[model samples]
Target: MKNKVTAALIASAMLGCLGTGVYAGSNLQEIKAYLNPGIKFKVDGQPVQLTNSSGAVITPIVYDNNTYLPVRSISNLLGVTVNFDGKSNTVELGEQTEGVSIAKGFDSSYHTKDPKVTIYNGKDYKDVFFDNGSGTRGSSFMLYPEGKYQKLYIQIAAIGEDLKEFTIQDSDTDTVLKKQDVRVEDGLVTIEADISGVKALYVHGDAKSGGSVFIPLTTSYYK
Candidate 1:
């Protein structure tokens, strides 16, 4: 019975598959370079500002050999519930399972072993090699090292404040959750998942400019 249940979950993949190599268990930095096809939002009849369509798509993202997009816009147009935690810098779209989570975030502070990582939001704030990565409203994903938590911080954010769009599975898993319409009050977001059975957490981004940021094989067992 347990095998059947697990099989159903794995086979259905309500959230879609991560990729060929994106294992449920791995130690390498989980950064998928797959260019996800996406749709643009439209209002009335033409491509307007708000998200009314879920068929138009944006091209692939060419970066580090990975394709990224804004996630915020995608969730909204798709009619999914979304949330962004600014304080903790994370995003949660849709519900995992009765309030469970398929969430992600970034912490530029994750990679302590590597000295070159000094950029925040893709910018150099302290003269170090940090990258500053933020989202406005689109589909994109990214992964960062959060040493404080001894885990990689995954993120799913929209691009530009420009109101972006994205694509997702439809139901059950992680892909087709929703837009980050709701905001986490404390900036501290949490997820209760079976991390033991799950080898890693995922960092997803939305489409805005550089697209969304993601970190595969990302960990999130905050203890």
Candidate 2:
């Protein structure tokens, strides 16, 4: 009887260890450490992660009093496929189970030689610095609709003597939406557009000149 009780206790302890990490009590945190910022988490049908500015995998984020991991690394570890569609401006992470459903990554911010707020969806996995492996100064984002917002917003650092102007247009259309001269002082300038029913959006701003941004719209997204 004594030997059986001891074996049962040992088994119970091992089972508890299986659900937790060495340093952390929560297994989710360990899983999240591998995910990219802005990739939503759904384990056993519950939301669990959020993205902060592009931080190194070593750097941890604390939100709602809980720490989270990056979505990029974690999902891949879970045997999920992650992909980006530049032509469609989409980033997607496949579902864990079979049949391959994109659970997140739509409108998720991506890096390019030139980046823009590129229609963020799942999570706003945006980085603070606009540098995308290149020294070129540009930015991009992909935004998902949380409420009643269809319009997109852009903000450029206002700086001294920097020629600032932006060209907004639809990539699918020959028509140019608007091109305006911008005066950026103190290293900041902000631009807003009322994109009601735009199918595709293209922007080129001369933080002096030369860049590309593509934004797509869904019918139910903007009202």
Candidate 3:
């Protein structure tokens, strides 16, 4: 006989079987389930091997003509962090912020001026190179996060003794998101902006003293 079961009930039952002490309560009902080892999982056209936290392979559970997958395994495959809260009997996905380097997504195609990604103080940084001898102004570049990130973190520092000015603007609306001044004496100044729905960003930096300012490559966060 075919039996129907909610995904939440299945998860709660699984956790209880694993000694998590979380049960579905008086409403709990038993359902027939079949382990379908022949089922294959693919992500982005690539085959993915599903494994539990103990390194054991896990297969899909077939019930009532429907397929059920483990929350943890699926979350891991998508680069998302998953956590089980036994106290509240809750499963959380993407609760922690994940950071990706801005250098990887840096694009200069939409820039008004030239900004380059280079090493600064033994670390990778994206900044504008200015020549005081040639009387060159500051530089700007573009970053297309495509509304995939929730926050942008910029760590700015002066190259030498000069103070640096940095500005972040929304490319689509031309609205200023953040503006800050950084100096060598202050060390690294971190600027955080809410880019929850921002599609593109224009980053501008200026240093009148001909010194270059840079933002470390490791400061973009998404949830």
Model number with the top TM-score: 3
Per residue, candidate 1 scores C-alpha lDDT tens digits across 1-223 of 1342343333333323222222333444655455544534353345634321244544444456443434433344343333444444444444322221122233344233243443334633222211235434333333221211111222222222222322322222344323332122322223232221122234322434443222221232232
Q: Score residue 168 of candidate 2 by CA lDDT.
A: 57
Q: How many clashing residue pairs appear in each of the predictions shown? A: 72, 32, 0
lDDT of 2 by residue, 58-129 (tens): 233454445444333333223233333444543344321222111123443433222244223342324322
Clashes of 1: 72
lDDT of each: 0.32, 0.36, 0.60
Give all candidate RMSDs, comma-separated: 19.2, 20.7, 13.7
Instruction: Name the better of 1 and 3 by lDDT.
Output: 3
In order of appearance, the predictions have TM-scores of 0.21, 0.30, 0.47
Error of 1 at 92 (Å): 27
Residue pairs that clash (backbone atoms under 3 angstroms), model 3: none
Query: RMSD of candidate 2 to the true fold?
Result: 20.7
Give the candidates in order of TM-score, highest first.
3, 2, 1
